[model samples]
Target: MFKKNKRISLLNYWTSRYLLTLFVGLAIISFISAAWIRHTTFQNRLEMMEFLADETVYRLTDTSGQNIGPMGSIPGFIGNRDRFTMREIDPILYVVDTEGNIVSSNRPAPPGSAKNVANLLDGEEGTKKITVTNEGQESVQYVVKKKLENNNKVVGWVLVLEKKENLTRVNQAYGQLALLIGALAVLGWCAIYSLSKRLAHPIKQVAEAAKQVQEGNYTFDLPQNNKEEEIYELVTSFKEMANKLEQLEKTRTELLAGVTHELKTPVTSISGLLQAVKDGVVRGQDASEFIQMALVETTKMKTMVGDLLAFNQFAVDAIPVKVENINVNQLIRDAVAQWEVMQDDETVKIQMDFLVKSVDVQADVVRTQQIVTNLLTNAKQAMQGGIVTITLMEKEDAVLINVSDTGRGIAQEEQAFIFERFYRGENKKYAVRGLGLGLSLSKMMAQSIGGDLRLIDSNSSGTCFEITLKKATTL
Candidate 1:
């Protein structure tokens, strides 16, 4: 079993981390933008108030034809005038002369603003300026001052009182908006968490499956994910690998049992025969025959062990093929000829059908011969006495060699598993004398040489097995 990590899982960590970053960034931006809007509204309000006051003073002086002086009732003229039409920030106008006495007033100043006015009059101030005065908890006011000058000498001042109502309204609206955005951010955090969990679900399943596999539980099923290509591929590949492992484990168990049976039969026979001879259970000639039979059994056991080793070599890719272009037709002919000399069944007839002569393919000569020999042997063993036919032909970009037998065909249920190692069918009436490794070994060798071996047809008539090899273009 794999050691579990003690830290937080990736899903939780990233979900919380990213959501925090998102809301924090939104908060910072909102703060800056709201502050900027309030400040901008305040400045613009001051400018508008200054413009209105200047315009009013200009009209009074123009109407009087330069006769209006600082002593005149300026407040009466200005107060009787209609109100200005500015919306963003409304203001009250206050005017004072060089002696600091109020010259005119459109509206009374908010308390505590008179000191600000006096400070302005006492200084050698510039012609135009704006300042802020806080009236404790009652209100805030922005003051715009315009110095009225006659030939650069201070005559009086135009004071504009722009209250903070518009600015305050804008800030209140921004506060509400901020609340709404914060609410959305909370909802977004939930969404992010769900998305992270959805993404992590499949990964967690795979991890659990892997742990089960490590504990030798190959039957565990992994959840499938078809939408994500990379994840799907990973899951499919792991399934295939697990299936292979399961099959190999089963084959190993069967191999051990089959090997034990095969070895024990021969060893027991030899041991019994030798014991019988030593006990004088047979005469000298019979004893000699028993000894010869024992030698044959030993030889057969040796061959079985050798076959097991060869199959193991194929499994481990230890058998290197020296590949070269060769005439496949000639190879098949030579293999058939060798089998013909070895067959002692007089009732069996062999036929050869070569559709295209001189067909060439890239193959290892020895492994190719071995493949043909194994197939022919299997065909011959399938029947007590029947016809075995070898056919060779060319396919598009490939070559095909089929070995067919005229005998009782392999069972339909067993065809799929015929090439699996040690997979013996129940049909034991004409069982051949060997472990069921010949077909499996032949199939592996064919694949090693970039070829394939498969049952083309199997029925009451016969069974035909086809071999496909890569065609050599150079030849």
Candidate 2:
């Protein structure tokens, strides 16, 4: 037979946990309240008994060592029904002499009650409860005895007896009250469980979405129209995280395809050129030119591979830079000069517009040089014979360098993703064949040195890349 298994939800779990603690706490309070009520009733009964016994002593004798009427007449006045009625059950009274002889009695004395009184008269005052059974019904009675004195000398005794049923009735009342409180507690727990269900509803949605996410599902809905701020924020954050993860997955797929295609072209070129030279199909001068071409392609491949490795390090924050104060203008000039020397096409003119003769900045010299080299190379490669302007100036508390090229600008749609890893724009003139990590890596390098690199402007006229570095403090 197939059996149904019940699933315990978040609400059930929280309810059980909360109610367990509440049950224990309320049980303790009920126990303490019951105990205190019983104790107070017992104390009140004992005090009343003592008060009645004292009144009897006063009525029996005056201060001049003389009886009011006779010794036997004491009980008649002490046991009078009109005088005291603090308890529903009346107490039994007995008057005795100092030598343990009974002088007056309210009722026929039971042997146990008399023995206890005799013990009390004979200096035995420690005993508190005395059990008396009458007509096959057993009951507990509190014993209270007071010394009767005249002229500060012991004359006789007055013993008062009250039943324990009065305190028992009080205890029964408290028990009823405790039952009512327990009912209220049950209602309160029900309310709490309902509230917990409401609270766990949104949380449950998020948990289910996350489970789906673990299984490679990133598309889901989280309603945020009408909800508490905290809950809204939680749902919003989870949605944003899912979107980011989806985008990252797409980027990874693109990178794999792009990297493969980029690497294959140069490798295929070099292989074809070498194969041609090896087979002796090409002559000496042409073979030498083919070899040079292969070398250039290999160099391009090396540069792409290096960029990939450096980007990986930058992603993990593992690339360390030696930070120091350096002359910004000189660094830019040196990078441009080196780039110009590497270029075979002298048709591309390089122009410098230095608004400041010397601009100092805090940066890692080598990495800063790398950033400048990337920009210069990008500008040179983007154009066939146009001017590449390198402008350096001071902007408030920072040094700014703008690299502009008179080539086809990056597409408006692709502008947002230009600095994204493995992202390539479709600008035909500016589309250099390589892994698109240079701008991303350059941006990371700039940020690592407490500086920034960004696309200032890119239009049909030209494209401009700006670099900002904090000014070095003068000692």
Best by TM-score: 2
TM-score of 2: 0.63
What lDDT would candidate 1 get against the real structure?
0.76
Q: Which 10 consecutive positions of candidate 1 have the poorest summed lDDT?
A: 122-131
Alpha-carbon runs more than 4 Å astray in model 2: 1-8, 54-67, 73-79, 82-90, 103-108, 122-141, 147-155, 163-169, 214-217, 225-232, 260-302, 312-364, 371-420, 423-434, 439-475
- Candidate 2 residue pairs in clash (backbone atoms < 3 Å): none
Q: What is candidate 1's TM-score against the reference? A: 0.60
Residue 51, model 1, lDDT = 80
| Model 1 lDDT tens row, 35-152 | 7777776666666776887776676555655645554544464645347656555566767777666666766555666666767664443234345546545455555666666555
**Number of the top-ranking candidate, with lDDT as the measure:** 2
Report the backbone clash tally of model 2: 0
> Relative to the true structure, how large is the alpha-carbon lDDT of every model?
0.76, 0.79
What is the Cα-based lDDT of residue 415 in candidate 2?
A: 76
**Candidate 1 displacement at residue 421 in angstroms:** 5.2
